[model samples]
Target: MPTTDNQGSFLNLISIRRNQVTAMDNDQELEDLELFQKNVADLFSGFLASAEEPSSAKSGVETIDSPVTARDNYIPPPPLLSISWFRNLLDAFLCCEAEFKAVLVSGRDPSQFTRPPLDRLIPDLLERSIKALDVCNAVTHGVELVRHWQKLAQIAVTALQQNPIGEGQVRRARKALTALLASTVFDVKENSNGNVHGKSAERSWSFGRRGGGGGATMNNKDPNGRNLSSFSWSVAKSWSSAKQIQAMSANLAAPRGGESTGLALPVYIISTILVFVMWALVAAIPCQERTGLATHLPLPKQLAWAQPLVSLQEKIGEEWKKKEKKGNAGLLEEVHRMEKLAQSLVEFADSFVFPMEEEKATAVAAQVKELAEICEKMEEGLGPLQQQVREVFHRIVRSRAEVLDVLDPVTKLPTPVPY
Candidate 1:
């Protein structure tokens, strides 16, 4: 009933409106993705800021006098790997991971993931996340190791806190400190030697039947003469943290060309974040065989988040190098403090006099107070941190499952069993 020209005109108008609507939707999606990326960057930026702040454990602050100007531009020294910092890191991951899952769900078309780039990218991200689960398990075990050290240190604390500070008390404290130091050194040596399930794992940093608590001299026995290694390892003995990290970071590079836009970009962003978080965890927390573990953060400078992440990675890397130089076990601030304070206490007890002098008694009390403070912090923080790690583990598993549910049937890719 209508002329061909009129029909064409009407269809053209409809097509134009449809295109306008599509353009608006695409723009909105892009904006949302960018905002997500910015939020993640901000979270890590906060972490970097906290890392640069002065440690709360310090008793006094030293100010520097500059003749040039009096602007008071003394920046704080970077903090060590702390429980609070690690918890915040985990919290950031959970938030970013949730937002990432939302982005994937927002795509509206399940078939989009089956398309080029995303089809490969999505599966790779999921697989990397699966590998992270084992690392989480290993980190949880590391937390247990720290807890064991805390308990042994507490024994020394209890003994040293005696009111009279007698010879007997000194002897008891020295014995506990000796055991504690030996266990920590043994753990580090084992990790360095790449022997994960050696006596270190068996005792979880406890003194074995050996009199001096030396790992080499100790038999296959716990301090309490029970098998504690059964409770030590959550992952397989052969699971090396460094190797697992390398596997996750393998082929992880910045998305380019067409892959740098739309969903693929966000996928790549999340992947980088995933690797960085796991790398940081491995660096800060003691895991099985973390020798030669390297940081794997590909800083794509074009993205707003990459700069801060790269900065944090470099700072962490520097800290790792410093720790390695000192033959330290991990970058955990409390652990470092504990090791120093415990060693000093052991030296003090070893050189103790029969009638403890007043100055010496005061020094011992101060060290005991500091040790107790660290113990208190560990008591409050480690349990929650271990629980948070478990939550992270379960979340990764759940996310991988959700993604596999969406992609497996459509892409016909092999579904990996949840780790």
Candidate 2:
């Protein structure tokens, strides 16, 4: 019953208030998208910065008695292939992933997840995440392999650390070092000869053939061998880390045109990060059949995270080129350090005299000290790294299931397989 002019005034005020609300929402969405991009960039920038920093100790052997300042300043080499580096990488992914999920939840219509671009992009991202789960499982097995090596190295360290390194101690250390090197050499031989496929009987920790004895263990004796089976801890012998990485990233492309909104941007960002992190794991951790692994990462410059990511990719690729044909277990810095020290110790033990000279004794002591440091690093870092990896696997599973529920309520995505 009110006049027409009064009714029009009331309607206009309501329309203005609605505009104000919509503007606030848009502003918030934009802010979140920007923060996500900045964090991804910051994560990779930190990796590059760490790589450029100087180390307190030399990459070569250094005495435990080296100046306190040097010991204090001993920053590890660039984080690319180190266990600590990988752990930090996983932490970064977990943070970014949580933010990404938040962005999806905070803005956009829930029904949009079932329409057009989101419908396709999200499902593809989820599928890549599933592939990443497989890589995580393989990497966990690789962690166990590294643990085995650490145990062998620790035996040698305990043998050599005695004040008067005795002949018996030397023999014991030699046996352990020989066993360690034999395992590496066997892997190299098997890889070089294309014998990557395991025989049904090759289900134990056998080091091909021992130097003087028949072999380290019967091919079927050690129960810890990684083989293809239904076990969550093992991967099929035919599984290739390189191939798995390739599969994850093969279809990953940046969003284009209308897909370049805040929602699609996060999907692409996460997909890129997921593939990069997996490639790094395969490169840094021991996995099956890694030869001929390509190291290219194609990212468009429009992405906020592209520059730092591209720089990191280039640095890792160069490192990979240097070690490609060496037939080493993986490109892990600790593994390389351990292998070098072990070889030198083997040579020293082989050419020893009953009563060692001062210079010879000092050199051996330095090597043992270095090996001990590597063991300690692995001991403290691997467990946490493996836990983070498992967390990543489970997180991906939950996210996929959430998305599946949105896309199709009748179908339930399975919980994370034990693997």
Candidate 3:
């Protein structure tokens, strides 16, 4: 058995080798990914040329500027891979990505540039690049450590996978399998053989939605019961799908009251019919009797003008039904449309929850409070006690003509009401 230091050093060398292999693999022109993967293995598995100086034989001609300098200076230091440090780097890496995503969200047209930069483009993706490098370093060290653990995890997975595997061994295998899969270094393999040390299953957990594809993660909680996000999201694997989804989301949730969308024709019809029938009935009744009507009612003179309102209302009603038929063809489509509508509301709620700007939300909350108060007042009718108002006025002035007759009744009074 190797000492921990020896294992750690070996793992570090492996990581350096892996990075070189990866760089070369990335340069592959072949369309076949398998060949690319083979290149990756070949790049690392072969013995790397040593840069250490060979002792010159007596009187041997020495070449100046050899590979020694290139090797020692360019190779990065071993990454910190302690459990605590790894976890911290993970946190920082993710936060940087989150901030980047937030900045990318234009809250307007993502493609159409607005003020400042005028686009979803952030000013300092350099920082993201830095974060990315940091993450890479963290990951590199993590992979080195993983190789060390793989030696153990493989043995565990193999023992458990054997025929008539012991129940205890199976549980151990699963526990080990989950740990291995969850590790950032090993979790993203295209091949399953590496998913577990020796287990054949290639399955892995997907995490975080990005560009478009999404993934899930295990839930963990603290002692205080405060929920912390340990999981990451990945967008759809298809780039086109991801881009489309992002665009669709951005447009649908446009900051300036989203553009009108296509609704199912039948949905429009039902919505139209409901509104028309309900409001037409309300229209026939006196404004005073209808809810929220009094405050919005036009003056008596405006009522005459509103004679067309009834016709207009009918026209609007007909248009709505027509529009519904045009947009959504049937009940099924309408229903699905409603489902998406419901999802939009959920998305809307999510908007308010995260990256919450207190100033904006507080202002909105204040406006909502005022509106709610006005609604309550309307419901209670505290300001519209017309019958009681008349009674009170009469008691105060049994005969305004009699009282005002002595006190300059002609003070431009429009003569009192005649009995």
Candidate 4:
């Protein structure tokens, strides 16, 4: 019923209205994309700011200025916000992924969006998260740190599963986490093992040797029939005689131990004189230094009686050195074992691909959780061993101090007067 001109005008008006509707829709989509970007940026900024804050005692405690703590002595930071930042970050990532997919589905050119590219931005976020976690691990030595890292790693794994674009970053994070956990386990075991061995060595060193019998057991009486109480006196006499002999010989150019003393005293005469002088001195010295008359004997002959204590000290030193060597070798072995395990973990992570099947994903998750539990158990086991090591070390130090106190006066006894 309408005229030709009126129909044409109506079609033109409809076209304009349709164009307006399309423009409005495009504008709303742009605004939404912008809002999504701003939200992502704000969340990430907050997370980074929190992560960068210096970890001090104050972080775990409520500040005086906190409104919730105004009525209380002190309150700890809530577990949800303080410890669950990684989980929150992961949730943000998931949201970002969903928005990005929506943008793709809307037939809008992502390149036209005035924001950072998704490929670059997502990877950067993942990398920063991993670095933050690494800092957390380095600064803290608590099991809580391990647990938190594991949670972050699990989330990262999920992120990788959801979005393949950030796979490289996610893989790197997994490798780092695996390496950290492996090294921690290794260190705990190695330290515990070393401490155990050291404790055993300390016990043997302290209780096995007789205190003043020149390394003989208390059950074994001296073969020469000397009283135990007089052992220290005998040792002092021998040491003094040896020093005198050393001082006298300083001016002489004696042959080395295996070398012959050409045209010296006859062997039989030297031996007989040595035996006679030793008994005479022991009978007469009475823990006193021999003076003028005793200088008639040669320097080498005077040192004979001191040989037992010197030999005993040398044996003790050798035993200590052997124990040290054994401990070092054990530590090296443990380090190598850890290195191998870390390498295997890294390889596994590198080769990993997020399984498409639900069963496979669940299985992988289970395995990771189990590994974390094992590490936790190892840490717990090391606790008691570490304590034992500390106690043993203190005991050894105390016992040594006591022994030195007892021996100090005798060792510092005045040198015998030279003949």
lDDT of each: 0.73, 0.73, 0.29, 0.34
Per-residue lDDT of model 2, residues 236-307, tens digit only: 456667887888888888888867765788888989988988888888776667776676777776566778
TM-score of each: 0.82, 0.80, 0.17, 0.26
Candidate rank order under TM-score: 1, 2, 4, 3
lDDT of 2: 0.73
Highest TM-score: give the candidate number.
1
Alpha-carbon deviation at 232 in model 2, angstroms: 2.2
- Candidates 1 and 3 compared: the better one by TM-score is 1
* Regions of model 4 farther than 4 Å from truth: 1-3, 62-85, 106-419
Clashing pairs in 1: none
TM-score for candidate 4: 0.26
> Model 1, residue 369: displacement in angstroms?
0.9
* Residue range 272-348, candidate 3, lDDT tens digits: 22222223222221111111211111211122222332343433334334332221111111122322322332233
- Under the 3 Å rule for N, CA and C atoms, how many clashes does model 2 have? 0
Better of 2 and 3 by lDDT: 2
- Per-residue lDDT of 1-419 in model 4, one digit per residue for the tens? 56998999999999999999989976876566555546544644554444445454234555455576453654332121222332343344445444544443345433322122323322222222222222121112222223333344444444334433245754665666564554344322122211212111111111222345333112224578754211111111122222332343233332344322211111212222222222222211111122221323233433332233223223323432433222121111122233344444455566666443566456545544544444454344333422332232233233333323433434222322111
